[model samples]
Target: MNERPRGIESVLVVGTGLIGTSVALALREHGVTVKLTDQSPGAVRVACELGAGDEWEPGGDRVDLAVIAVPPQFVADWLLDLQKTEAARFYTDVASVKALPIEQARRLGCDLSAYVAGHPLAGRERSGPGAARADVFLGRPWAYCPGRETSPRAVAAVLSLIELCGGNAVKVDPVAHDEAVALISHAPHVAASAVAARLVGASDTALGLAGPGVRDVTRVAGGDPDLWTVILSGNARPVAEVLEAVATDLAAAAAALRAVSVDDDGAIARVTELLRRGNAGRSRIPGKHGGPARAYAVVQVLVGDRPGELARLFQVAQDAGVNIEDVRLEHAPGLPLGAAELSVQPESAEVLAEALRSHGWHVP
Candidate 1:
């Protein structure tokens, strides 16, 4: 990336949370002066301490760009207030939903020509300054939604922001961006929470029998509920539409399961077809770096619970001359061994498994 975005020497990040700090840190790395601010002084202080950027000072030098990273509900008001000052030449936001904020800003009579809306389709299950990483946007798509009357300079500035963070800039309309995210992000979050919610009143025995399948489905459900509530509220319509479609599928699956349990005719075929459709839908998801999904082979190994075991496993895998695509670890209760599942390119799985066993590691 360029050392600094053209004509953008300094940036004022208006929130010090995860996304805000990440943007500041990434910009600072490329020689852009950045000022960090938040409603809470302590939050800004922590972000600064983490080397995201310098603390914002009153009457400081004006910035070339100002990024409003506040919550969805406060975005319009904050943008309006910032526009009233000569704080920045170009204004953009990292809010999850774009259309509502843009509409609100228009109603508030904000300078439409100087503003654009952007959202990075990336995040961790964690939140806050503590979880911020400069590389969070790498290999992610950052959607840029400029208002109809937005100027070329404003669009370029926001595009530079995305490039500086190592993200691909995907130009999209505000309404289209909202709908896409509802299907991919917002609705999935709600679904994950629903799956997790089922465990709240589950019996201890049922919980004990859970495995990676349950854990995977409910992982994002651990996110901050308060923040999710605000986001869901902001993009309520699109999210509701997506959830309604999902509910229809859920009803079909439920009815099929009930019919199968009763040995009804064609019940097995109905269940199988639903499962096949699920496989098809899941296969459409892009693989690493937005490429077509590739099937990987999993090689499971039982390793002793000892110091340096994981490092040794990796060393052996490297010695086998196979690249590992992914990995997972599962520990058995009251056992000294844990299962390490390594996912490699399908053609190399058996070779890697044999090599690991040849090196005295149990491969199952």
Candidate 2:
């Protein structure tokens, strides 16, 4: 097949951690040749074993694209080092924070025409190659920032790379990218960590009462602290600004709750307004396929924590010609039972519920 202008046929993936290995795996899925390298030999070996790609060696032919999947602080320097060796015809990075890295690249006199900074807004709370999945970036927004010096060739190459990984390319300014992610990703992680930290010395009773709400709120707190530290430090100002707003709201809520001890009607109004604002903010989040926010009907089923139980639930839904749009599980701690909250179209909810009930399954 004839390729487009310097289309990405082969790629060199640096840093075989979660993002790098995931990108390599995704490219391999699309029949793109991938070469892997990392600071840790063991890490790269694991990635290769996981079918991400083959190991890289010096003096090999320069690839069409190089993905520098290191941290934000190290991305620019790594780009400079790789460019000195002509690692690829075009280059990009998977560092979440963009402005600082682009600035560093300029300060180092790197060839900006060959580089585009990118970040895929997708990841698990876990880290390392073991946590990498080829589908991690599927349907996710891949943000790209090409500076004034960036060549059209570089932008085209990275766009192909994002498409190969099942991502939608979104062009953004470097500083704006940092600010946006600060509001959405970085600051939320810090807030999650703060809430999770409060659970450190809780009593067993309090812990037992913990449910999916707490888990969902604190889920991202499980991310690698050292890595998050680098990302937050790179976009300190924007993240700090977001955190300040969050703190103000939280402090207000606390004060309003304390005032309710005196049977204050104004305090109740204040708390209610905060909750209403939260509902508004949540509703603004994009739903499936980047469409308008939708409200799906939920069908809850008691699930057995054993093999094939969840599959059986899906089978029932399928037999009823119902599609499951989303799912959330609430496990009964120390028990072998849980609730599988299936989200489907409002029209499909009763059909699925009836199917499950007829199949000797408890649908609640």
Q: Tens digits of per-residue lDDT for model 1 on 53-142?
A: 898885778788999999877888988888887778899999999999999999999999999988887777678987776756654678
Clashing pairs in 1: none
Cα error, candidate 2, residue 187 (Å): 1.0
List CA RMSD, all candidates.
Answer: 7.6, 6.7
Model 1 regions more than 4 Å off: 1-5, 288-364
List TM-scores for all candidates, in order: 0.79, 0.79
lDDT of each: 0.83, 0.86
Which residue runs of candidate 2 sit more than 4 Å off their true CA positions?
A: 1-6, 288-364
Question: Across residues 1-364, which tens digit of lDDT does each residue of candidate 2 receive?
Answer: 1123237889999999999998998788667889999999999999999999999996799999999999899998999999999989999999999999999999999999999999998777679998787756754689999988999999999999987775768999999999999988999999999999999999999999999899989999998899889889989999999999999999999999899987776897888998999887776765432325566777889988763466556656767998766666677555899887777888998999999999999986
Clashes of 2: 0
Model 1 RMSD in angstroms: 7.6
